[model samples]
Target: MDTQIVRCRECPLQGCDTFRPLSEDKLEYLESFKQGEAVFRKGEMIMSQGGKAPHLHTVLSGMLIRYRSLDDGRRQIVNFMFPGDLLGLQGAFDDDLSHSVEALIDARLCVFPRNDFHRLMGAHPRLGYDLVWLAAKEETALEGHLVSVGQRTARERVTYLAVWLLDRALATGVADDSNRLELPITQAQIADMLGLSLVHTNRTLKSLREEGLVDWAPGNLSVPDMDKACKFAQYTQIDSKRPFI
Candidate 1:
């Protein structure tokens, strides 16, 4: 496979309003600091829990999942990372990765050596601000996920997740004006995310389909009516601007 060269100024996601573009000098400096790009196949581990995090990554394409495993071998997915999401920042601060990141599909990443990443942030205050903003956004997503898993019913949990993914896809410019979106995850992964068993997850999805709230195929999930799906999930839609890092 040929490696696709990633240039900061020519990034396809630069059009995302949430991501502020770096100045010419900063962009050039970042380009100099970049080591290269790495590609991973679906189901491959991008970064492992407890492993050395030598570099920070910017997701250039494809989806990823951040997760942690319990001593008993149960895994809880913490979040789904789309394009423009930053990875290994936590390790940049703590010197090791606390959770693992896996590619949900074939993925590509722009890599920056950890030391150079710190230098870039320090020398460019605007970039530093962007990093902080990204971190806060991630924190907010975690809080929402916690509430969904802890307090929501199985059906509601699934509904909210579907809506959330669709919204995210739209915000990131991956999907068009259509309500349909492709979700490549399995029911088992959804069960892991919602803290439910595989059987229960299947049943809840069936209920949603029966109610005309959603349509789920093997690798695609679509909401026929976004408003109705939100109502079924008891979700109040929030239109927050997302940053592209």
Candidate 2:
């Protein structure tokens, strides 16, 4: 597919009725502004804290991190972006950004200029409704991360993170009950996202392997039975509106 047509073609999010409620014509139009290039380099700030919002970005590939750094240089990653995640829509209607968005890998983004985006939302009320839902989902994901950091044991934290990805991948139709899925991320990245030390992450993975909850191989993972894995992680299903028909 041509890079400029990504929103209409390869955007995993274009069909996600929750995040995208625009018609194909609108999507095609929205995608045309995207320019089809690597938006930012890893560690380069896409949107800095306190910066005025300009564009709403949809992750087309690779991962991004939403993080805030302390005065002492300590950082906490609030959320990790996946294939279909949205950035810049979780903030105030008129305030500056509260956190910085950085690519964790070489990532591509479909950029929607804020002015045009607002016009689109006005023209399609369903798009506005869907944006609200997407923001709520980001909040929910942040809450989940908070719980993992605050309450879960090391093993449970690993389980929580793994189960999180498995569920997300399946929900997005990228994986299934078989737990067969692509995993292009590293253990260090997983630790950062889960708020775990590298050693602790290894221990947790070893424990999960011993208990047969999941298996990790080169470039992928096998969950065997997603339900069983979810049970191990104490995962509970949340009900949300079906965003994609």
Candidate 3:
């Protein structure tokens, strides 16, 4: 744990643009309630499935993958969590983690003990509303993922995932101005997320590359035109104002 005080108002990653700004009093209260910071190396588990969820984590930097494994050890990635995302809220309500969260890159997080967070929310209705708003956004994303896996073709699935990820990266300032986003997950992991075989996922990616829709090399992915990309994926943009927490 890093003990250096991290003031909420001074946080760079979860900016006011990405999340609703807290009032000065609310900020001070959160700063005091925050336990500290914790760092996770790439591939390290931040929260394990079925484990006690004692805290909620605010991503200060880097990326994380949320996944669940079956009885036979097959894993499906539920979502990619970026900077400004909140983690462990489900656990805060349920007492146990339903999925595991692992660092996709070297990451830092602000840790808030769940009990204190609950108390703060109880006292601050406005803050509590923000939390619900965050949960609803997460639910919308998950619903989209469910639709992708259940009805889309392999090529469309791949394209949809790519475009979706790029949009998030851009919104969160993870991507450079050139529209290039870092994708550190392996093809095998992607296959799991898309519900396809490894070979099928590779072929789909190759087709996407040949069509000039996307470029993937090493650890980076670039989308040349988001409009075209979304068209190929049959993506319909959801219109809603997102609240930042």
lDDT of each: 0.82, 0.68, 0.82
Question: lDDT tens string, model 3, 1-245?
Answer: 98775678887743635455667888787777789999999999999999988888888888899999998999999999987788989888767787999999998998988867668787777877887887788888888889899999988888898888888877777776587887787889889888999999888889889998877666888888888989988776534444544
Which runs in model 1 stand beyond 4 Å of their true positions?
A: 1-3, 234-240
Q: Which stretches of candidate 3 lie above 4 Å from their native place?
A: 14-16, 236-241
Best by TM-score: 3
Question: Number of backbone collisions per candidate, in order?
Answer: 0, 1, 1
Q: Model 1 misses residue 189 by how many Å?
A: 0.3
Which ten-residue region of model 1 has the weakest summed lDDT? 236-245
lDDT of 2 at 208: 84
Candidates in order, TM-scores: namely 0.92, 0.77, 0.93
How many steric clashes does model 2 contain? 1
lDDT of 1: 0.82
List model 2 lDDT by residue over 1-245, tens digit each. Answer: 13444435555665553343546765665556454444566666787887876767767666677887677866667777766667777443667887888876667776666656667677667756766777777888888888888998887777777777777766555555677767666777677777888888778788788888877655687776667878877887544543420
